[model samples]
Target: MASSTVNRWLRPEVYPLFAAVGVAVGICGFQLVRNICTNPEVRVTKENRAAGVLDNFDEGEKYSQHFVRRFVRNKSPEIMPSINSFFSDPKL
Candidate 1:
């Protein structure tokens, strides 16, 4: 009589626990996929390849220096104020 009562109390509860865990796992998987699909910056549509352009070139340092010199702008010379515009100058 006691064995029958024990089985009856535990049998239905185990199925509900399994169902709850399954639902939790499904929800987590759905959220993970949704986040990955929403982000756009990391997409790679280009046919990217290893930079195999320099296999023939040995003087890479000269090319690098030339590119840097072209990219950088030189600072302008400081302006001096005339006698009339002396009040406009910050140095005054």
Candidate 2:
């Protein structure tokens, strides 16, 4: 009886969860792209890549991104704060 109940509702009920998850993901992705586009300090251009930090990141701006690749790779939140602190340190 329990198995039959699960089989009946599982397909229909599970879809709302999928839709909720999709909407959540789409909103988050949009926000990220929006922020990146607005920030002039982290401008994305072929010339910037060729020149490295000399041309852009070290323009004495706060929140300058030098270690973006490393920052994104560390997914753990507990470890993420440490990554921020390490990167923010003037010693680096």
Candidate 3:
């Protein structure tokens, strides 16, 4: 009686576990084939390679330099006498 009960519990669960493992392996194999067929250089060329052409090269560095110049120019009090007047000692 106990053996029959053990067999009943084991028989129903085995096929589901096998099916789940088979599905997981099939998905991994499909993704592996997909990645192998897609070339990295082709993908990069399709997206960002055009933006990295000569016209855009060093753009970020140039913009950074422009930003530094603007920031330094704005830092001096002479750029706006009104700003100094607003904060200057009221007693004077």
Q: What lDDT score goes with residue 23 in model 2?
A: 100
lDDT of 2 by residue, 1-92 (tens): 99998887679778899899899999999768856764555558788657655544444343444366457656665657788878887883
Q: Write the per-residue lDDT of candidate 1 for residues 1-82, one digit (tens) a residue.
A: 9999878766876889878888999999976774455323223334323433334344444444454476554633335436
lDDT of each: 0.57, 0.68, 0.64
RMSD of each: 21.4, 12.7, 19.1
Give the top-scoring candidate (TM-score). Answer: 2
Which 10-residue window in model 2 sums to the lowest lDDT? 57-66
Identify the runs in model 2 with alpha carbons over 4 angstroms from their true place.
1-10, 48-92
TM-score of 3: 0.32
lDDT of 3 by residue, 1-92 (tens): 99998787578668798789889999999767655554232234445556543444365455445645777775655767787778884965
Superposed model 1: Cα runs more than 4 Å off: 1-10, 41-92
Best by lDDT: 2
Clashes of each: 0, 0, 0
